[model samples]
Target: MSDVHGRSSGTGRLVTVLAWALLLIGLWLWGRGVTGVPENPARPGTGDVAGLGTATVPLPPAAEPLGAAPPQRIDIPELGVQAPVMARGLDSRGAVDPPPFNRPDVVGWYGYGTAPGAAGAALMVGHVDTESRPAVFYKLSTLKPGETVRVVRADGRVAHFTIDDIRVLARDDFDAQQAYGPREPGRAELRLITCGGSFDRASRSYTANVVVSAYLTGTGP
Candidate 1:
């Protein structure tokens, strides 16, 4: 991936790989738990305590899941983001590949996972910064519950999700299930992820991850 100036940089590549590696480990653990594989005990602080179940604002009930369709774009009105969505596969290291660094305004969806409005959690990842400038999800941590996220699908339907939980999960104690797992059985869920917390210049990566959880509350043509 290219850097902010459209030139490939070693730092940019390192940051991208390290950031996605955090989720790769967590997602692997989550898959293990689902398949009846014995799992490692979670660390004491792995829970989403930063902003757990604190949505005092009432949210609408979840809508029924729609048929699978690829997402074409994503809109976060609260953050002033209207970015194209592209399917991303895992990198050689097994981490979910992110959007190219030059395209800082785009969002990457985990193409192998659940579709946005499907009956499971759809995973999306974006860059918080591109070494020099803020990226598509730079303001993701500031989002509050009850805000709206709209995903335009290829089937010509807009899946509107309502934000209900946000967390800054420390990398040392990250929990994949809590960050990416379904909040409620049979509800269409979405997870927007980006690097968060203070950047570690030494490691060229952030210390934590911002995960915004939402559920499908309505739809539009």
Candidate 2:
């Protein structure tokens, strides 16, 4: 009986792994479209400064990328956001698993991707709202360029970023690479993502995603 139980448990784990693999493949296909090319341009629609090549205000120059270090906390002074950061992996649905509804004040960093201060676009996601009220990123879309976003790192240094772009990308033609990709090569960039547009009752999801792009401008102790 013990052997049989062990075999059953092993089979269950295997099935779970297979299911995740299938779901990831499906998500990749859906995002890449049938022809393996993105269905829309890198920036589509008029979601707030889509046609504008740069921020409306003058911004500081990009700082050199820092070495890899896990992030501990994030602060957006303009939005009055000072939240703890937790590393998160992909969920069963093959997407970044955001903080649980109960912990709506937390931010989830993509653990499998670039570190917050590394030379790549680090991805951070949070819930815009729970069933009852607003979440951590509820005011994310309201952030304008030139605002400051500071990330406290585990290495005892704070990475300061300057907001450069904001886009409300439609869900129908969402391009992961474009939304999360580094705007400039060798710069340590960050993308803060949350749900935007209007919530749809039929689909039970937001019609678009709010993507706020920023790059490292300086560091602090």
Candidate 3:
């Protein structure tokens, strides 16, 4: 399939093949207790204990107004993704749980963490593909730096964010902070994450993760 740019490029083909391979591997891993899969690690809560006996530091306060409800929907015009957001938490391994294959159209928000439009970085994860087809965030990498991501909140407000950066981190070197860190201190931010880059048939997993970082730039009704 062609990318959002309508370019029949080789990269697009690789992405397609890798997507299917990734989903297959992911399903296989899920059945086997998620062992040996290149899964992204769970992000720690901001300013929380690093380990045992560590001094506690306070996290930055939310920048949004009081009572900004949880995100109900996410819309990315450039990628043509409009999906309901479901709250997801950590799995047995403490890694963020992704949406199940049965609901490929849904997105998973790290509900235990800051809500989108709240202070700090709000994380949302989605599958790059399903068993036989591309899923909600299949074209996530096609998003450009200047694009906008709109999140409709349960409260009647829409949080508008401007894409600041995008990174593809190899699973071997994935850093939780880079994926979950607030781009600017005390500012509300969002991170859209999915698997991308090369797929490893031997390991049965994708080699990298695509993390899109955006910061709150405006708001709407």
RMSD of each: 12.3, 10.4, 16.4
Of the pair 1 and 3, which is ahead by TM-score?
1
Residue 50 in model 2: lDDT: 31
Off by over 4 Å in 3: 1-67
The ten-residue window of minimal lDDT in model 1 covers: 34-43
lDDT of 1 by residue, 1-221 (tens): 11112225787667645645565574543233211111122212122234444488888998998878899999999778999999987765455677887888999998866789888788998877664556788778878899999999999999999999988777767677667777788899999987766654455455677788999999996
lDDT of each: 0.73, 0.72, 0.65
- Pairs that collide, model 1: none
Q: List runs of model 1 lying over 4 Å from the truth.
A: 1-53
Which pairs clash (backbone N, Cα, C closer than 3 Å) in model 3? none
Return the lDDT, model 2, position 149: 98
Task: Please provide, for model 2 over 1-221, each residue's C-alpha lDDT reduced to its tens digit, 9 standing for 90 to 100.
Answer: 01111235777667645644553453333333221111122222123333323398889999998887889999999889999999987666566677777898999987756788788788898877666566788778778888899999999999999999988777678776677767888899998987766654555456677788999999997
- Across 181-203, the per-residue lDDT of candidate 3 in tens digits comes to 66676678888877765555666
Which one is best on lDDT? 1
Q: What is the C-alpha local distance difference test score of candidate 2?
A: 0.72
- Residue 34 shift from truth in candidate 1, angstroms: 24
TM-score of each: 0.77, 0.77, 0.71
